[model samples]
Target: MTRQFTGCLLSRQWRDVAGGVAIDLWFATAEEPLCAHVTGEQSVFFLSADQWPQAEVLLAGERGFTSSEPGLRDFSRRPVRALYFPAHRQAREAARRLLEAGLEPLEADLNPADRYLMERFITGAATLEGTVERAGGHLVMRSPRLRPADYRPALRIASIDIETAMAGLELYSIAVHGTGPGGAEERRVFLRGPGTGQAEVQAFPTDREVLTAFLTWLAAFDPDVITGWNVINFDLRFLQRLADRLGVPLKLGRDGRPPHWRPLDDDGERHALQVTGRLVIDGPEWLRAAFYRFESFALDNVAKELLGEGKLLHGPERGEEIGRLFREDRERLVDYNLRDCELVSWILEKTGLIQFCLARSNLTGLAADRSGGSVAAFDFLYLPRLHRRGFVAPVAASTAPDAPGGFVLDSRPGLYRHVLVLDFKSLYPSIIRTFNIDPLGLVLAADPALPEGASVPGFRGVRFAREGHLLPDLIERLWAQRDAAKAADDAPLSQAIKIIMNAFYGVLGSPGCRFFDPRLATSITLRGHEILNRTRDRIEAAGHTVIYGDTDSVFVWIEEAEDDPAAEAVGRELERTLNAWWRETLAAEFSVESRLELEFETHYRRFLMPTVRGSEKGSKKRYAGLVADDNGDDRLVFKGLENVRSDWTRLARQVQEELYGRIFRDEPWQDWLRAEVAAVRAGERDDQLVYRKRLRRRLDDYQRNVPPHVQAARLAV
Candidate 1:
């Protein structure tokens, strides 16, 4: 039987055998390989179908398993989801695809003999996933009508996370949250590990009574939802194992409830963490929704980015800090754990993730724990409503994408050119407001343009199209009231409206949301692309240059009629007056119902959008905007906060800024590159070069190809 998993691939440990490699995959559950045989020579990777090359793949066995694969690993030892690619050749291709997906690809180039042995099991692509008859003596093939993301989930949500000792020996804490902004307090409970009772906040005398007191408290807070970060793989497993060893019931959560806590059977056997409850919401899995590309989602790093505050404890001795919190200082631990709870709450609020979770639940008919796709969500919501005297949701028409290689344009700095860049802030939300696009309404009314709070039209057999679809009615009312609030200038009401509007888009786009309809999303984005392009053309036709645009922002270059100051002033004034005319003209012409704000962003006297160092893609979102003063002096700034990013050491920013600053100001450069290189080699300003890079994950994963920071982490560990 074929097994499937969603996970990250780690390093390959090569043994003395000719073709054997110990591959590690970080899986979401504790699963063994689909086939029991573990080949010595194998390639490993994470589970994602998008990265796999379906064409080059000769065997289904070798193609990386997406979640849709036939079998699932049991939820227990949730390590890297292990997959064995017997030979290195197939693994190499899989590795390349993984690299494209933004993972650090690992390859083990073993001897050729192992490569040959691994090829025996290679199974290529299926002959046809879907077939169509050919009228002209040819057969066309396609995959199944993939409602690419149709999984909507039920909203009985539980946000769970775990805290454990660094030694991986003891469970220090376990917290489960509810669907509300607060984790658990709303309708859930948090269970403290044995260490919680001795917390410094209350200053209990002995460690022995602390664990018992915490358990007693747990007996009171009975819960259905169990949550945590890798709680199944680590936290709950350790706690249950410890309880078994001590011959005690793992009386966990509120009300000292007794649900059998099993002991660890053997190596690779499923453990306590795998025990299922009503639902378990992994904080990390949910966090993946945000798409924040940062190294390691450590508690400290995540807290700082989302909450603006982290645990007061700092330094290389975090393990020691954990010990101190439990042993020497219970108060600090309470503060720390409570702060983590708050951060989780803040993240949920910022993303409206729980709302999506609930929305997904309502759409997919799946429980909260099941991750659903957009197509699944849409189908779930649309089909039942259709069945009650209804119709099927239109399956996405598979077609070629718009060809790449669209030309990128640039706007160079001209003499005193007063360029007015017009921007549409939150265009999608506005479009939703004007168009009456509500996902809930689509589910209920299924109408192209439903009015605000309009009763969903009654279905042939179903009722309440009259009352309105739940989500759409909710959104329509929210949008209408938001508009009212905005008009009335009620700050709090306006905020609520904005929240609901933003949440609509996220729900439409989110895979876990029930209304994850691509049509809903496409309707918004395609319109946006059209608006941006049309706006540019409108400006250009009016005798002004629309130099560049990205999404909602448009950059313009005011034609400099002359080089001298007197002539430049005349040109700038003309540019500003023309901008006002364009704004009014767009409003009068199209009933698109949108507003644009023009800002005089920069006075770049000289600029360069150099092609990316390795590729011909003219480096976009990377450029210099500079201006010169009367005394042959200049100052420069980078477009993308290039100066502050920690990876961009002091070297590049200073050199680029100085070079442009002088060039823009009519200052002649003589041998500038030489001086800059010498300065760097001499270590004249080395402190500026000392970069503190963040380690994104645990240090063990980097055992093979060690980055400088990874090496630093190893030393620290």
Candidate 2:
């Protein structure tokens, strides 16, 4: 491995480690290693592999020993692909595991998807040995826990992409960046490949041989992670193939050897990868999983949305412009490639993806790419240990709602007799503010007035700000500001702030977020459930009702009946009265700023907060009713509906959304369904929607299973 960052273990430490990207082990029999007191990496080696068996147990508890394959003598001499399970077996097992865990798994795989998946499983399973040891289980392996924080090589890294000529025969440019904090230290740059009409950063080099020398020089910065858009699928593969044909070692060493990646299953899911020693963050895949929605997650679009500026190259212009720059102007081409890396890096800085992945793996024993639970890994190494300690996890909660659920009012489509919408312009943030909720703030805000550092009221077991709490305080400030904003109708500012505020919780919830703490998420959601239920009760006592709510908005009905001529006047008065009532009642009672202002969002003549679809019980996230939107269309939308969820297909979302919209408006649907289904059966609708999961990996590894969506993706290729 090229000189990489190790938090504490100096190159001179003369010790070996037990874990690697696929498998690594270091042996140091010293009773006390150096630098043990540090928070993370400093702690790993000093504690010694044998001494910190507790930590090792936590990790090993999740993975099992790979049964050695028979007739595979001279393992080191076998092809890298021949080592573990076959592609089809891995894919099938992945699907089975996901289904068992209640996560709807995507079918089949393509090149990138398969490679990334394999990488995911391989690296994922390797850790099971250590986790098994750390969790107070058996001594499956002796090594340091591959905690993400310790694994973070550098805050500043680079992403390289290339466009070549003559079918993988020539050189091209590369991009570099460092994503997280301490970004200033990182630089984005690229080198040019030989092509038509290009000037040299240095003198021109002929053949792929000279280009390899340049890559060696570029390798010095010692990047923490190197990423790309589709560099693995297209660029790296080409480079490797080119180098191999030339009889030279492609020693652009970051990881011990070439990185491993997997393609998606049939029906074209996505791609993912894992560099052995180095972290390889893929821009396209990470952005999609982060919920960045756009027509295309191309370099330009994502970069523009993330950074204020993107590559000068635009849609159609990218190819000709890049090719020309490579052939004609090498410097600009390098600059363009570098700029692309910067764009990706900047977005990642703002979005804590790497942090989340680490936190997630640490928390629930799930890989970011894991669609299925590591049941054997969990049961053998984890559950027993936790059970012994008087801790037992509840089964996965039913997604369906319970009786007397959140929704309690009846409504319809029309001009609201009087509708008051209570919106927490950023509910969680507002709550943070109103209640002064923050991780760090919890400690500061903790009342010396109260003894024993009591937990926040209405919160179950969450002590206020402690030595290391940031999100709580962040949520608090935003929450408070949102309350004040709602009181004054700062619509634009509120919306912007609200979007960011809501997003914070999401990022935090994601395992990919660095701040991923189940406690933090639990603190927010469980408390939210507590607070919301109480708020509803208060509203009901006042004779108004919470008709519907999703995350932040609370729909309400306030009676306002008057003589025909004064009907409009009465409606306005009722809205005003209810708004005032909510603000005062909540403030005097709960001390939470009631962001309950009536928004003239829509006039629902009729709305049904359905009983959980199959049961006559109250529903939580599902409902369907009529709304006369301002656009003059009466829409009957579904809430807590099963059809619009992630497991459902694009077809399902479309069918449900349209069906309800037409149903509420009392429009004809028979013809539409007939035509659509017929077209689908005739294979005419094949092109309508193709599931393209976002991942970063090569495009070849997908060979066997072929789902329709994956086939559609192949068409794009």
Candidate 3:
């Protein structure tokens, strides 16, 4: 019987069956987990029809291989044919043979499971209709027909943290804290000990017992997401090693399968972890993916910053402290272990990072736990649309020409009053939409059959087809959805859309993406350059002095405005006038509707465009300003300055903030500066003189031009 169900995709993988490969897509619904077992699908790649004769001759004797005309053309506009094989390995072998014969196989590098989902245009949420049967604690759907759906699953999350011996060779305890289905709270700690008196703490005789008990508890809880601070690289990795040593299988997957670990680099220093039906989301990784920055990504630091609470123990001596607690204070160790788990849970909850990850997955068709996959995300969103448009992208180029970046005008160094900032909203994306910049559009515009007036000019002798583009329409839809999300106060969805939209330019410019083309990237950036220059000219023509401009924002000195309201009125007027001018100008010049939006972003009562440290020339990105807060109190803002940089000393940041604040307010700063110098001379602020920096390489690796941090590290060594 065919039954329908809606669920959110959690994980997907493919395995070799008897005669072919079968894709397993795990999903989480409101009531239970389900695995969609899809088979009878051929692994395929495309080749130019011109090369099809040679490819067919090369693979003539191969069994389970077939070829067909898919009616698709490559980016070069050459017709392409599809080569299908029964399994991925055979397809890979065939592509290797073609490559060895000096022929190109397009898109053969894509994972089979990813290709399956991307071809179907199914991202995260999906509705499945197929024959279903109950397996062990879950359902398995055979050959499910999947379609995209508007569903978001409320995932059961478990945040786990483990305690280890000082040598990191022995596991001391494991703590888990999270909510199960229906929001029921659960907390438990498995301790390897001879003594225990704390509630929710289960004591076992040995490390193997503790590990086994924790795995059993995890299976019973059945969490859809498993998260922790540095979980994959530290805790999970350590547990995997311990389990191997103890001759016990670490079964953390919902399907009673062991976690799969793969080294990310040649050195094996980092690993990627995947479970059958769960996402292993490391807290710091997801936080950075969401653009959250902190001076330190340590659990204690993040917890304190986000939750106003931290671990019971901190600092460099934490390892020794944990050992002592394990030996003498087992109960305290339990508390500490559980506290760390709870802190990770609270931090993720406070930041809404899980929701943000899910939102990104739903938008880009990437996995919910995947991070830093801008190229893959672009492929996930673009390839399906391209295929539907009767085209296929070539493989990523081995090399791509450099593309220009955003425009940054030289600054006019000065301390001025009533400076207003005007910015282009989503400048790159707006450029893409207004100018019809796209990979397929660029290809189509060069066709001899294309009408001259049906294309618009781009940089570097390239043109884009006006009505044959896909990216502009995609961005327009995302823009509208973002607006709706903002109206509904859906911050996660809004942020996800913004990140994806902004990443388009970079993806096109990146040599790692299959659609990489310098012409497409330069078209957007150079267009931005043109827009900023024209905007600056217009602002200056409107009787305001253009102070500084960077990328998408322009700072104007409204000297004639007497107060904040007057300056704001000028800004609003200029915004409206400039936006209207752009609309009319683009329509007249290029015959395209302008999506360019000039927004009045901020009005600083006092603003400063600083000069270079050792030169009279003004700096481009360095600036400071004083603005009014919501309560009408003055607030200081800094950019590209010591006060906002983590590598600078605390003393430098403190003095810079104080000096800038006093100067902006027109207060007596000379005396304050003298007092601060005197205090520094007297060693009153010695603690603030210390600099904190993270080393990116080994100490011995810095043989030339060693930085201060490297010098300090060598000394410590």
Candidate with the greatest TM-score versus the true structure: 3
TM-score, prediction 3 = 0.98
Candidate 2 has its poorest 10 consecutive residues by lDDT at: 37-46
lDDT of 2 by residue, 161-245 (tens): 6656544366665445544334554443335334433332333445454546446544555444566776555666666667778
Off by over 4 Å in 2: 1-154, 165-171, 177-207, 241-255, 266-271, 291-296, 329-331, 350-387, 390-411, 414-538, 550-553, 557-717
- Top candidate on lDDT is 3
Predicted structure 2: clash tally: 108
In model 2, the Cα lDDT at residue 356 comes to: 40
Please, what are the lDDT tens digits per residue for candidate 1 over residues 273-370?
Answer: 22222344455565663344433466567667777776566566876787767666655665665555556655656655544443334223333444
- What are the lDDT scores of the predictions, listed in order? 0.45, 0.45, 0.91
Report how far off residue 608 is in candidate 1 (Å): 7.4
Give TM-scores for every candidate, taking all chains together and pairing residue i with residue i: 0.46, 0.43, 0.98
Please provide the root mean square deviation of candidate 2 (C-alpha atoms, Å): 16.0
Model 3 steric clash pairs: none
Error of 2 at 522 (Å): 18
- Between 1 and 3, whose lDDT is larger? 3
Q: Local error of candidate 3 at 410, Å?
A: 0.3
